[model samples]
Target chain A: MTILLHQNLERAAQALPEQTAFVCGRDRLTWRQLDEQSTAFAVALQHAGVTPGDHVAICADLSLPAVIAIYGCLKAGAVYVPVDHSSSDQRLCALIEECDATVLVITALSLNTRHTLETHAPSLRLVVSGENQPEQRSRLEVVCFSGFLAASGRDPFVRPATTPRQPAYVIFTSGSTGRPKGIVHTHQSAGQYAELTATAYRLSSADMVAGVCPLHFDMSTFALFASVHAAARTVLIPAPVLRFPASFALQLEQHRVSVLYCVPYLLIQLLERGVLDQRLLDSLRWIVFAGETFPLRSLQDLRSRLCHVAFSNAYGPAETNVCCVRHFVPWQECAEPDRSEIPIGRPWGDGLCRVVDADDVVVEPGEAGELLVSSGTVMSHYLGHSADDQPTFCFCPATGRRFYRTGDVVRQNADGELVFVGRQDRQVKVRGHRVELDAVENAMTRFPGVLEASVSCVPADGSQQLHAVYTSVDRQALDAPLQRWLQSELPRWAVPSVIQRVPTFARTTSGKIDHRRQGQQMAAELTTHNKKES
Target chain B: MIDQSSFSRTEATRQILQFLHEELLNGSGPVTLQADTDLLASGTVDSLGVMRLVAFLEAAFAVTIAHEDVTMENFLNASAIAALICERQEGAL
Candidate 1:
């Protein structure tokens, strides 16, 4: 018997119907309400012509309705693609078109982008507003969410027969190419990840997990699926509260959140500005950080302050959801301020990993090379791309397993733990979000009058920031418009912070753009400028 | 005196709204922001935008905003920001 993601919800509903399942701001949903509402939503989607395996793109923030919509899509046997609600219209339209999404579960707050969606997403036939009733005037059929559910009647929805091998969801991430690549995960893969994570964290019904990451981010799967697997409560932190660390701490304390899975940058913010001394977050049992390396000094400070919590450094690309995790109790390990890197640890639960050279040959035990992951949690394939794509995956003949090529370069230490070295590509993590420099340059070149664009990563204030130098005919006139255009094209973290117009880019002997030289120059100039200002 | 303070707050609110619209938002945001709009809740301003807004207010109003004072209550909206600025100015005087 195969178990699907929504089956966890059903089991929990039967076992703990009155227990709170999800909480977002002032809204709360018990297991029974969540189950019934999601069932109603499933019926609504079916009535609205959403067939099994159809793509239903959810464009809403972390809210109760969005949670309901996710479960609803799963119950209806439709693939739920979570889109960043704050993304620009052009990006949203591109995703909707790429997935050929027939239905969109959107919040009222994002209705402003409807016009663009109507024009661009031709396959989008139905729009279900999560909030207020929209006055529909578009070619696409729009319905109020509440009304849609009410109209579906009380008839029990027949669960669609779905295999574990069927695609459960598609998450889009920054690609080396100009466009975003959608990573598709089957129900088996995602369900295996949820079970592994729940077992690793020792989650139970008494635990309250903090849903910190946005739905679009891959890390959000842990909070969303793992909690359901354990029948635990999930407190979806609102975006606004996240901006103020003090407020975020209040939310954690108020909810007595037991487990938090977020990026290191957010945890750093909580340490610096969260007023942790005032809040008694004694309920917090585990703090898992991933997506980027945590600065050792800050990690020490955070550990010192929150002495009771166990810290884990989780590592995996979006292709493989948390294949490796290093767990450490602060007091157990020696605090070495000089240590710069933390080990990403061994593969989790039957997962296989190996470091391979450029020729796909396995490297020596201590040698640094690109890491490959073969795990049940691994994504099936990137949407619209062949599974045999060399850059994405490599076949291990020795083990007869397909492994994801995690562009990350790592070395195995004496303890058989993987230590991060550097990237084998131009991909960099900016505030825990992946940004491909090539993609940023491509977006800049899309602007009118821009001839060429070169983006460089500059270390600023303990984190990496992107700086771009573009060649344009009209440098002075193109500044504001180019900035606006880039804002509309890329995610906020991917957009370059400092953009300068240059006559020409420095080139290497091979005629390619010299990014290393440009990055060094920009860093030097910024340092001098800061010094002069001070 | 009360009228003068209220007038100054209104003026400050206008200037802040203009700055948010032109600088932070870049006129591409989903909703048009009013003085009383919940900038945080509405997603009009993000974490980076909040930092930039604080810097802009410090320079524009000639008031220093302490790190501890950068709470949601003091920066929830244009009106709230103006009130924080006014209070800081009064304290300085």
Candidate 2:
């Protein structure tokens, strides 16, 4: 499969010669067309001295040609690093320098961030699309994806040779201090994850997926890579559609999209907008939501709203492409409060899950502990400066095998289902009392029509106080129902002192709920309101 | 837009106040309305504010702030803020 990541297109192009593999805004490309276009781009990249294992940085949003560039690098035996097109210039340049990439492929949308990179990164090479700034283009060797496609690659396809140990792709996730962390993956490891996961989802070429998430996000990797490897068609949703719910749903139906992969926020918005109906989504299957835990109320709203499709929970970090997933079969069955709770479910495809305490001792069943995952899907580690480059091996102490430390706090129920506790750092100590924010969130989600809820502890005057942010299908109308529900079940301290609802929660690149912003908003709102009254 | 008052762009303290008044604009927050004294590191101004202030000075002075301009000398308190803006504006004009 490592060999095929570069060479797989060769066989796929042969087997499905004229079959449509990708559709971009009324333009459909067959396997033959995709293969030819990508090969031509790779040959151009190779000619520009992008040799085997050379890092090729991609600076573009989701598009057919951009997608081709990602795989083309691998095909030409080089690793691809994707930078978020919307990221700040300072942030983008930091990542480019850290990856030490010598070549960059960019689109018109990504050109603004280039003002900081042009004169710097002396070894950087370029391939531009749409329009070129000739003065800027001369700073680096620039060629367009279209221009490259028109160029000749006369020879038949010869797959570039790369060892299993070779670098495949580098995705930069957010750092604690707003810096970027470069997460590197190998073709051998990412391929195993992609293939097994495709089988788990029962994907085939018959499917046409709507690619909503950016390639820069790890959660989007499943859609981007899996569809290519499984020979399914994909359409990049336009930016406007991505921002608004109704437009996004309309685009899916208009494109005849059969698979939907997005964050819970996007899914919740689709349900709120109610653009999807039986006719619109009949062909759609395998709706995977990850990036953050789903509010049970929103999950139920989706089940009741769209009763036909399959909804699945996808859980993982950039370190491992995908670690675990569970099907929300008979999703209506899970609509009941006790039925579909926040169980991240078990590990995916031969992966092992362990709940261990601070002492590294496996906790008794149902006890909360940090989750340690050991799997073939485990990451090698952070690049060059990594103190330990060796992968964290998943081990069963009883059986004596190495394992991966997931750093996730999880507990196994009697049925061996894993329920995510909040992060280890978020555990609350109030008057030396322990509180799980998820527990508070669980109680609040029970409120009728309350789609999502996030709880955080922040200093009010001197000590920490519980604060909750939520959204309802009915806007601020759900406030009364939420207050009624929490009044019955929660203690005074446990109940969020302030429940602020928003149009949407600010999410990080990987899709985790951004509590820091909520906390800031809380402080800002308090000061604003207090001053207004005074 | 800033409500202009009689102040020298060369004075570090006044320039800091101008940068704060421009970037923050007293938008429904008491903290912004309260003090112009300790704007830096008071959580009143953040990393984003620093970036915007740099850009604001570039247009206000018509001068380029180098990548090396991120040091505390140009960024500490309002005095530092005013000093950087004034230095750039004085030379720029």
Candidate 3:
């Protein structure tokens, strides 16, 4: 029984040992090599005092070694926590401390942050460097990855017995409370997600999947777990290559990538700037977009261009790993001309979905309500929260199941497909990553000079961008320092693009800052400014 | 015709590095960037940074960089960017 996530890697290695499993730039790891290295690394982790249920943080870019470290953590029965290596030192330290990670697998790019981690994360004892052995200066024991793996014998490490309910991994997402919340997924939940994704896409060993999203993003699960489940080759697109659309498209063509699961933002970039007319991308068979809504016009344009490729819209929050998917039939889309937004489709596999009103009563067909999902793919719970403390899940009396509140308002169309209306909360998707407006506002207020902050999401270039209007005494002097502070506190996607200093904010009748009016005024000003520039 | 004598390769490379350090990086980039520094692989430049660099290059060097020209070959390093600028200027002339 392949209950654990790493079992897929072992099975793939046994079936297709010599096949290329992962490719990143010039580095490629065969299935056998990946399996063997991961097994050895698992033993190494055990020797380094990593016990079952311990959190192992991996602060590295998506590379062959990082992938191996992830599987190694899983094999060792330790929950793997992937941290964005590009994030500021402060954010990295906060995540490390929050997760109470005992061991850190870091790459050379982020090696300098070890000093900060040593001071901030007291639970961290061992540091496994992906590069050459750095001189140990801190209390944490540092070991080179190559040396550590070599010390462990060439034999496979004996697997530890673990229940399906045990935590497999923890993915941190933007929390409305200003702290990034860790969403804990059990072995059963993650494994089910991998199995469902492979089955849904009909992924095979012949398919070359493009791993475009970073490891920290939930969308990366499609590239990591799904590809492993089907024994498919995953080409990890480098961060730099992802920046240039032409280069990104070239990678797709060069690798003959058949399946690509990414956000709408990247697809829009490829359509506008990728110069796809010059490249032959017939190898692309399926393109699945999730995390945010794709603009219909851009989607239509892309469909027109890649007539052979199938497009799917996947829907689910991080709490539920892609419970629903809509595969667009080219003819059907053409038949329905008036359809403005793509439906999120029906629940897949054993997943159950309910749309309910404020009273928790199920809404009638075609009525808009908050989406509730119950499935094997649903996460166990947040890391710091107990089952009782979590307000995200509610019990459904009819199904006798706990359903996760998605906070997304959706309405059922005539075809029985759920169409996304809008977010019921202050959370918005920026470049497909969730950003809570309240969180950004809170971070801005943390700055010494800022008195009040209000953040708004504005649609720009097919994706959403954050804009902040704040009241500060030192308006001119605060701009650079405030930006620097926010960049250090939050992820790049969460940072506001425009920060305007306002004398006073528009207030509601209750004396609370009216965010809607402020947002409208900003949007109006932006539109007028853009028109004048053009 | 553009005056080729006004700008040398070294001067162009210096200006590219300066722009990268001041504008794209916002003083958060590496302390020193060599001519052969691998910008893309090192995570020195991101996607949005590349767009800004392209615009800066076009406006500063008086060269129009096509969309297809923004590949790793030309933008991989300061030297490569300078070379692309010189090539564009020569092509225009």
Instruction: Report the number of the highest-TM-score candidate.
Output: 3
Tens digit per residue, CA lDDT, model 2, A1-534: 344464556667888889887776677778888787788777777766678878887877777787678767887888888887666677666777888787777766245455567755655666456444444435655666677656635645455777766778888767765666677777766777778767877778888877788778876666666777788777886443354355567677777777888888778767765355523666776688887778877787677777767788888766877777777874555544465366788888778777899777889999989877766666656666352433333446587756666667888777788888766666886655778787788787777767778887766667777878886665666766677678788876687777777655656654457776766777777778768988
Question: What TM-score would each prediction reach against the true structure?
Answer: 0.81, 0.79, 0.83
Error of 1 at A366 (Å): 1.4
Chain A accuracy as TM-score for every candidate: 0.81, 0.91, 0.80
| Per-residue accuracy of model 1 over A1-534 as CA lDDT, tens digit each | 348999999999999999999998888999999999999999999988888989999888788988888999999999999988777788888899999999988887355577787888899998888666557676988887888888889877988999898888999984324788999988889999999999999999999999988888888898889999999999999677787888888899999999999886678668766888889998999999988655555676788888888999999988898899999775435544444457899999879998989888889999988899999899988989877787788888877799999988889998799987656677789999977786677667657566557788899989899999876543445777888888988899988999888755554321235677778889999999989999
Against the native complex, each candidate's DockQ, computed on alpha carbons, is: 0.42, 0.02, 0.52
Runs off by more than 4 Å, candidate 3: A109-112, A154-156, A330-338, A388-390, A427-534, B1-4
Colliding pairs, model 1: none
- Model 1 misses residue A473 by how many Å? 39
Docking class of 1: acceptable
True lDDT of residue A293, candidate 3: 61
True interface contacts retained by model 1: 0.48
CAPRI tier for the interface of model 2: incorrect
Q: What is the DockQ score of candidate 2, to 2 decimals?
A: 0.02
